[model samples]
Every structure is written in structure tokens, then in C-alpha cells.
Target: METLFWLEDSIVGMTVSSTQWGYPIVLSLHAIGMGTLVGVALMLTIRVLGFAPAIPVTSMAPYWRVALGGFFLNLLSGSALFCGNASELFFNWAFRIKIVLVLVGLALTWWLVQICVKRSDQISPAHRILAALAMVTWLSAIIFGRLIGYWS
Candidate 1:
């Protein structure tokens, strides 16, 4: 494997020399996106869990939209950050683990969305169970993402 570290020196140079504060700006958005992604995801899951019947299931669609928005925000920011620290990330085992978790979480989230749409007419219990699982997957992904930085 190439290790994808071919540009480490250049990436490090750019990352460390951001007079325009691009890194901080991207990081800030990434953080905000993460908060929205995890927060809204959990809230919707709880709604599906029946915390608020006032919230029509269709309302959750907006949250799903926000979730997608978060996904793009994080995708861009995370990719740039990753490119900027390829060497460090490549060596960080915790980061590797976090990446795997995130992949699984995203796949599960997509599946959850599909199921929710198809079973819109299904009763609450089954919906609640799947939503609960989605919540767990998202929560675990976020926790592991944090652990990557802390542990590495």
C-alpha cells in the first residue's frame, strides 16, 4: 500500500502555515456539524422512540436532511484535515478504529433511513427498536471519533 502519506511533508507545511486560519475555520464547522449530526440524530431517534408524538414522522425528514448536510460538511472538512495530516493519521491506530466505526455507523444510518421510509406504516415498537439501534450506532461513532483524538 502507498500508505497515502506521499504528501505528508507538504500537507504538514500547509497545515502549520495557515495565516488565513483555514484550519480553524474548517475545524469549527466540522465541530458544529458533528454536534448537529449527533444531536439531531439522537433527538429524532428519541422521537421515533415516541418521546413526542407531536412531532410528525415527516418532521423527522428535515432532521434527516440536516443529517445529510452535516455529512457533507464533515466530509469536506474531515477529508481536508485528513489530507493535511496523513502521516499522523496513518500511524494512529485509534484513528483507524474510529474510521471503521464511522463507516459502519453511516451504513447503519442509511439502512435505518431506508427502513423507516418503507415501514412508515409499521407500529411503534418495531420502529422504536430500529431507531434505538440507529441512536446507538451514531453515538458509538461519535464517541469513537473522540477517542481517536484523545487516545492518539
Candidate 2:
């Protein structure tokens, strides 16, 4: 656990010490990636929950894959963005809340993927509830994260 945090710290350190434009560029991409991941995830989850019963559930799974790719891209971008301001992020109250919310959002998504998707062998009706919750939580997380930049 400590090693993982250390790795994150190292990445953040590199970005922080890099040129100013580098930070902004990575941050922009991170925001874009977040939008892609969250948007697609919400859409797919909603489809699973029966909101879009006309849509094939398995076909919708592919969108989640696309979302996973965006998530990885965001991981890279987020690393650079954080690396550019490691110390500040570590100290920011809003940033901390944002991180916690992100964790919760991820956990909820994972839970839905396993319980609703795996058990049903397709998206379950329960997915609608999970999707709605995910949207709210993820949107709040992103908004709070953006707010940190503005306030700081």
C-alpha cells in the first residue's frame, strides 16, 4: 500500500517539476478522459437497468470496454496532472473529498459490474438504480475536483 502511494507520489513529483504548459495539457486530457469514462459508463449502466429495454444488453457491454480504455487514459493524464502539484493536492481539503468520492464511485461501478452484470449474464433491472447513483456520485466527484483548481 505504501509502495503504491509512493509510486503515485513519484509520478506527481515529475509532473509538478515539469514545465507549466505540461501540467495544463495533462490536466485538460484528464478532464476529457473523465467525461468519456463517466458518460459512457452511465449510459451503459442505464441500458442494463431496463431503461433502454430495446437495446441489447450484451451489445451495450462494449461501451463499458470503451469506458475502461478512457479510464486508463485518464489514469495516465491524472498522474501527470497530480505530479505537477503533488504537495498542493496532498494539502487541499476539497481535493481529498474528491478523491474519496472517486473511490466510492469506482467501488459502486465495480459492484454493479459484478453483481448485476455477472449474475444475470446480462444487465439486470437493478442496473438502473446503480446507474443513477453512479451518475450523481461521479458528477459530484468531478465537479469537486474542478472546484479545487478554481478555489486554489
TM-scores, one per candidate: 0.79, 0.75
61-135 in candidate 1: lDDT tens per residue? 656778878888888777777766676777787778767766766676666666664447343577778788778
Error of 2 at 107 (Å): 1.9
Off by over 4 Å in 1: 1-3, 10-13, 16-20, 117-121
Every candidate's lDDT: 0.70, 0.71
In terms of lDDT, the poorest run of 10 residues in model 1 is 10-19
Question: How far off is residue 49 in model 2, in Å?
Answer: 5.0
Model 2: residue 118 alpha-carbon error in angstroms: 4.1
TM-score of 1: 0.79
Query: In model 2, which range of ten residues has the least summed lDDT?
Result: 117-126
